[model samples]
Structure formats: structure tokens, C-alpha cells
Target: MRLAPVRDDVAGFDAGEAAAFDPQPVRDAGGSGERITSLTSWWHTRWCQVCGHTFRRGDRVLVADSRVRHLDPTLDCAESGGGRADEAEVVRFTEGLLATWPVVGDVPLTRTDDVPGLLAPPLGGLRRAACLFCAHTFRPGEFVVMCPCTPAARVCARAVHRDPARGLPCWESWRPGSTLKVCPVTLTRLAT
Candidate 1:
């Protein structure tokens, strides 16, 4: 079996000293951390698979395995090697490392109001969206109702002005006396 060079370690070893070195490949977070060394022979020098340079006495070189050859050419030691053999398996390995990665930047707070229960604008502000009924922009602090017509799979219709006193009579004009209250965005029939 070809040992996977999962451990990202670099070590230097003399010609005969590598025979004594016994390194282990990284399996998971709890894996034994060992440095992988590229051997330099007294009789002849070995060429690097990545940079095409001859391995000198103490050059830091990354060693690849059968698994590494399947990785992207930019990352792998083999220049022509490309495409992931198992993207899901690669994700599984990195997911553990990603857990330890530091969290950067604060998440923006959701904006809330008394009228809409639990439903709030994303990132403390409403994205500028026009009302399909009146062709008017839904401004901030405006009382608007999202069309309940859309299914869970599809994107919901644009918000219409609910409070006619504060804004344009969009909701009133859209609903009453219409044979079909189809959502302008999704073109789906409104749930009456």
C-alpha cells in the first residue's frame, strides 16, 4: 500500500541516515507529527517532482504520495497531476482543521421591528427592492408584506406596501377584485 503524505512536514537527512528514519503519515487531528525528508544520495542526486530541480544536501522538498498525485497540480509534487479523486474525502479531512481555524470579523445583527413578528431585514437593513404592484421602491421603515404565495423551494415575491396611509396603495390595488393574485416575481398564484 502506498502511504499517503498527509503530514505537512519537512525534514533534512543525510545519505545513509534516511535508512534509520521511520516517519508516520497524518491520519487526523490526533495524528503523530513527523517530518518527511527528501533523501540526497552520495552516488547521484535526485530530481524534485515539483520544481524540476535536483535535490541538494539540505533542500526543503515536499514529498507526495498516491493521494497527493490526485490533488490539483498547483498543490501536488507532480506537475501534470490534476483534479481531485475524492473531493468529499478531501473536505472530510480539512473539516477537522477548519474547526481549529480562528473566526474573523463579527456577524452583522438582524434588524427587528414590532409590526413583523420574528421576520426581520438581513444585516440590520432592508435590501432595496421594488414593489411589483406599484413599481415603487420599498424604503426603510415602510410597512410592507411579503407575498405568502411562494413555495418553500422558490424565492418569495417582492414586498408590497401594506400601510396605505403611510405609502402607496399597492397591496389594496393588487389583491381586491382580481381574478388571479399571481406573484409578480415567481408568477405563482397567491394564497388567498
Candidate 2:
């Protein structure tokens, strides 16, 4: 990946910024004295800090994010017609996704509160979830991950009745006043 030049204003004068601003210099792992080629390739070959899994390039992967937790690195799925993913791979994949995406279980806030905290301006991307039971897909517009109910109560409800095959209530089923949860297109549970 191409890295942009670090702007003076963006770098700031903070001590913390100085320590972690640049990517660590990668040594020749095999002692051949050649510089590493790519971030994705280097990450796969080197020891991953987030998850302990070591990997190589050309591995098929999946990404997941839980906003409450750190993002995972790219994962090497065991079923991806490749070898089983190591523990480090799994952890890194989780952390990377969380860091990159507008994840579910993320803390909700008003624009005034959240905007300043963001690293960049709001991004438009699809956020998806799969039903554990029937494998049906749900996107952000179709469902609200951060429910208004208590966390414990909401977790239980989500676990017990989130199967699309079971025909659980739509977003409107619970909150009639919510304009945010409906499908942006058909205003139904499954927005085409």
C-alpha cells in the first residue's frame, strides 16, 4: 500500500504521536538483507502483535469488527481452501476490522460528540451481519446493533431471537418512532 507523506499539522506535537507515528522498520526476517515489500505481505509473514498467528501472502481471508473491542487483523480462515489460521491471525483480523469499519456494538453518540473523535470524516460503507441460525444477512439500515435497551437485556434478546428464518420482528416491530432502522429502499425488513 502507498503511504502518503505525513503532514506536519496531521502529525501534531504530541509525545505519543512521535512514538507510534511511523511504521516500525521491518528487518530481514530470513537474514537475506532484503527490505519487506508490502504491509499486507509483511504483516502475514511477520509476527502479528494483535493475534499470534503467523502467515504468508496469497491467503484467503475474512474481516470482522465489534466496535466495543479492538479491530482484528486479516484472518486466514481454516475453511478458505487453505491451511488453518493460527491464533494470531484470528486476533489481528478482528482488531483490524474493528479499527476500520463502523462496527456493530459500537458506542452510539450524537454528531457533535462523535465527529471530533473520528480519525476522518464519516464514511459510507455497508455494514453486514449474518443470522447465526439461517445465515440471512442484515445490514445497518435494516437493523440497529446498538439497541436502546440495557446491554445485558439486549444481548439476551439478540441471542435468543435474531434468526431471520424465525421471522423475528422487524426494526419497526420494536420502535415505531425510529426513522433510522428502516430499509432505505422498500422500507421493509429486506431492502432490495
Candidate 3:
């Protein structure tokens, strides 16, 4: 019979450290507040499984969990004053990110009316923008860029250009204030 690892009051030996001691795979949430179903040494590194983008330990990376509300479509385009061409340019910028990142899990290439309701408000808006290429989503006030080549235009700009090996895709920009949230992979912008 195996005994569980005893948890102590040590600083680094918090819940996360204790969970790692268990021989059986532990299901828990990460420090970033993301729900982690399993432990992976891969996460120990700054590399993002969803997009294969690397980061330093303290660097802030966006985690898109569709378990929350889907992004609003009304906010997809530029904020009225911004011209259509300007919106198009933003979209182009997002496409570049998708081309570069690894995109961890299966993402919908197109937008669907079947989008689920808000499990909870994302970091920025009434709903979070789901990634067109992977499981990632933007929190409220969180910004991302996507590629036009993707089925929709919901990619994030910040992480998109970080990795050069992935290269740039024809993309567009999606800001948090828009009424519609466009899917970078499918280019489908859904209304809130």
C-alpha cells in the first residue's frame, strides 16, 4: 500500500507541490488559475501546448478555456471610426499569429450559431473569444490577433508573432471592445 505525500507549510510546497507527490495522476488547476486535468512536465516550461509558443516563467500568457462564454460577434470589426481597410489590416495581423503557433487541440475552423453560453465572464467581456486554431480563449480586456487564412478571425496578435518558425498568416486584429468576436480560423464573426 502506498501512502500519499504529506503536505507541509513550506512556501513552495503548496497544493501544487503536494499534488505532484501523488503517484497517481492528480487532476487540479494550475497557478495561472487554469483547470489542469493532468500534470505534464511540458507545462513546467513556458511553452504553450495549444500554440507551441514559449514564454518565461513570469510572462503573462492568455489561456482560452471554452468552458466559459463564447465571444460576441458584434465586436469583431474595427470600432466604427476605424475604416474597413483598417479592420482588414487587423485581421491580417491575427492571421500571422496562427501561422506561427502550434495550436494545441482541435479548434473550430468556422463560427457556429451553436456557440455555448457564458460559463462565466472572461477576463475582458460578456464572453471570451475562442481560438480558431486551438482550445485557447481571450479573457476580458485581453487582446489577440488572427490570420485571414484561418476559417475565422479570432487569433491573438501578441502570441502570434512571438514564434518566427511558425511564420505569418494573412490575418486580422480582434480587439476586446468590438461588438462581434470573429473566429480567426473560420472568419466567422458571431454577434453577442
Q: Evaluated with lDDT, which candidate comes out highest?
A: 1
Flag regions of model 3 displaced more than 4 Å. Answer: 1-24, 27-126, 140-143, 150-192
Worst 10 residues of 2 by lDDT: 63-72
Worst 10 residues of 3 by lDDT: 161-170
* Candidate 1 residue-wise lDDT, 5-45, digit = tens: 33222233352367557654433222222222223222114
Query: Better model by lDDT, 1 or 3?
Result: 1
* Runs of candidate 1 exceeding 4 Å displacement: 1-127, 148-157, 177-181, 189-192
lDDT of 3 at 192: 45
**What are the Cα lDDT values of the candidates?**
0.39, 0.32, 0.33
TM-score, cand. 2 vs. native: 0.21
lDDT of 3: 0.33
Q: List the residue pairs that clash in candidate 1.
A: none
Least accurate 10 contiguous residues by lDDT in model 1: 102-111
User: What's the number of clashes in each of the models?
Assistant: 0, 15, 60
